[model samples]
Target: MSDRDTRHKASMEKLKARVEEKIASANEQRGLIIVNTGNGKGKTTAAWGTVTRALGYGYKVGVVQFIKGLWECGERNRLEEDANLELAIMATGFTWDTQNRQADTDACQEVWKEAERMLADPETYLVVLDEITYMLKFGYLDIETVKQALENRPLEQTVIITGRNAHRELVAMADTVTEMQEVRHAFNNGLQARRGIDF
Candidate 1:
């Protein structure tokens, strides 16, 4: 073949390779389940970081705070105003704060049901189940229901479950599990949780 013809053939091959790369990248979907467990301060923070990242990408995000009520989460307050996000926090406060086991359980059941809807909805691209492990630990939420939600969530949606003492089964099922180990905490030294930093 002439030199010109050889050059044209090489260009065609390059174009074909580029088209294949585009197709492969487009076909790839994001399906991730991250569990932030262990004793640390940043579990929910890290999960919210992911939510912020997803929101920056124009994806719909749902945040479900299991035990924490509508009191104040700086991140939640900020994201709640965004039209693309939905915030559902159990406004009944902590179980101990409420001092009623049955009531707390009922409240968890109610909020968790709402969270379930977000998990199942394909339109929701990111679902953050914040402090859900506390619900499980308190027996307010069923582990199996949480497990099933993870299993049945939209294949392209990203899910985050953040709390201490994440169940082994949930950890096993998660695509990424981060265990935050607490070496030394200021709270142990009599420092209260600081605003914007801890809240």
Candidate 2:
């Protein structure tokens, strides 16, 4: 082999050995708390990907839309057809748009009940709390309440929390935290959000 190809093969072989070692050392398996947060987009979209993955395996899945209100969601439209999925969307579109603190808080609490149910369901393999960080950010949902619920969830049931500005406590406890940084968006360039692509 050429010198360049020989060096690349050795480097890849070393990387494979390291990865196999780490995989072998991970003996125990348990539920995970995955946080998707940042100012960028795709937070909910990534969680939806996980939702579909779980459903494809015939596992029961639950979703609670803490901030997403009455709107056309293409992902939701497709996922709704599955019998293993349970979705509860909030009534208020956006707290900023509604400008009603009491009403928004009320809706948050109501939907939180559904989230609590999903968290407590042992049969549910995965639960997606989409856009829930907003409720926590707005102080509509208590951080302690969420923390306690997460702490008490089934040992083998994973949960995904997606939205910007995830609380420190949530970040601390999460097994995986993905922050989507906004580099540049087309909306900033005077282009409207496309239906299938943006949503």
Candidate 3:
């Protein structure tokens, strides 16, 4: 064999051994708290991907949407067709459009009732709290209450929260956190959002 071929074989062997060791070390299995947040896009999209995975596995999945029901969301339409998924949308429109703090707070409280129920449900393998951090950001929902619900939830049930500005408490509690940073976006260039792609 050539010298390059021998070196490549050695590199592959080393990588294979490292991967096996890491996999062997990872034995504990528990539900995760995943947070997707940042000023960029794709937070809710990532959470929806996870929800789709849970639903595909025949596991019950729950979704509670806030501050985003006004859009013509193709994802919501697709998710509704799944038998294992329970989707609730708070069509309260945007906060700036509503211009009523009290009304927004009332809407949040009503939707939160469903979220709390989903979190407590043992059969729900995954719950997506879409744009929930907006509630905490606007003080529509209390942080302590959310933290307690997450802590006291079913042991094997995972939760995903997606929004722009996640609270400090939520960040601290998350098992996995991903922040999307925008380098460039088409909309920023004065282009309108596309139907299925942007939504």
Q: Compared with the true structure, what per-residue lDDT tens digits does model 3 show for residues 51-95? A: 878888899999999999777888778878888999777758788
lDDT-best of 2 and 3:
2
State which candidate has the highest lDDT: 2
Clashes of 1: 0
**TM-score versus the correct structure, for each prediction:** 0.83, 0.98, 0.96
Check candidate 1 and list the clashing pairs.
none
Specify the highest-TM-score model's number: 2
lDDT of 1 at 122: 97
Alpha-carbon runs more than 4 Å astray in model 2:
none
What lDDT, from 0 to 1, does candidate 3 have? 0.91
Pick the winner on TM-score between candidates 1 and 3: 3
Per-residue CA lDDT of candidate 1, range 1-199, in tens? 9999999999999999999998988765578999999997799889889998989988999999877755578887777777889988786887778899988888888888889999999999999999899898888878888888888989888899998899888889888999999999999999998998888
Instruction: Go through the candidates in order and give each one's C-alpha lDDT.
Output: 0.88, 0.93, 0.91
Winner on lDDT between 1 and 2 is 2
In candidate 3, the residue pairs with backbone N, CA or C atoms under 3 Å apart (3 or more residues apart, or in different chains) clash, namely none
